[model samples]
Target: MDAMTPPDREAPAEAPIEALLRRRWSPRSFQDRPVPDAALASLLEAARWAPSCFNAQPWHLIVARRERETEAHAALAACLSGNNRRWAPQAPVLMLAVARTTFPQDGSPNRHAGYDTGAAMAQMAAQAVVLGLQIHQMGGFDPHRAREAFAIPDGFEPYAAIAIGYPGPADALPEDLRAREQAPRQRRAVADFAFFGGWRA
Candidate 1:
């Protein structure tokens, strides 16, 4: 239940998959330990390698480590919605994922910008699992406030707010969250979505 023995929230995959993918799950309880700079660098590096359309690499991460940037971290936390503000601020790191909506070269709209940003975060999430860390990405935030707080520029959109740190006991969370945290992981069967050469309604 402590950081040394965090709960196992691995996904019950229907088919065999890499342990890294199976092991990753978002958690609201994070330990007090600060993520090391090296580990942070490695995570960003993993994200940097994610593939993107036209190799545009349109993602940008605004990171705030609680210990290192206390004020900045607080400012970022203030942008979270009430539900997220309850648990997300406990993590040692907070990040805002931003996407450049326009192609830099031509100033034209890039429809895949958000998709590519998500791919980058996916890679970062995998890296977190590898580092014995966990990340919970949240859509519950005020993007306009985040833009004002961070001075995010024009043509850039805030996609998600992320809380990252080592996992902690489910009991550390409030009663409701703890219940949800310990609940079984669920996913649709592959057959439910995958089809053979044609779409199914």
Candidate 2:
């Protein structure tokens, strides 16, 4: 089994995170277990509270629980790249985060929709960490396939797909993934990303 104390698995941060940032870490190996409905609800509730541009709240979360939403679960699963498919399916829950590209009231372009959707997903990820679940988001999925499979409307765009569940044994993964699981997490230095008086690239 994976370590019960997930926080210990976190990479040393340049600066501390509040409430420990739930010490969140992403792992591909997930136990063959079902996420409780109550926990799932809390995750969505967390996402719902994220701030949006102009209060537009353009994110639409499409959730497919392995047990409750089988067809949807399969469709979402199918959209994953072959590598992701190997591990993501073991998670009890899968999710697609979609962004509405226009304002609901005026139909004008909402240039900030993608940013808003990201905020919502960030909130959801924090909640998952707090609840002892790890989420793995994939950009490798075919967006076109996801749109077709889910019949996503023209104005809505799929931003990311997530796999959620309890951490599983590293042995469950292929050798490459197993090595990846053990590697230290990486991030650019704060100076590289954060700037002071003026912007710096």
Clashes of 2: 0
Off by over 4 Å in 2: 1-8
**Model 1, span 76-170: residue lDDT tens:** 89999977999999999999999999998899999999999999999999999989888899999999999999999999999999999998889
lDDT of each residue in 134-160, candidate 2, tens digit only:
788888798999999999999999999
Cα misplacement distance, residue 7 of candidate 1 (Å): 6.2
lDDT for model 2, please. 0.85
lDDT measured at residue 172 in model 2 versus the true structure, 0 to 100: 89
Clashing pairs in 2: none
lDDT scores in order? 0.91, 0.85
Considering summed lDDT, which 10 consecutive residues are worst modelled in model 2?
A: 1-10
Top TM-score prediction, candidate number: 1
* C-alpha lDDT of residue 164 in model 2: 92
Query: Model 1, which residues run further than 4 Å from truth?
Result: 1-8
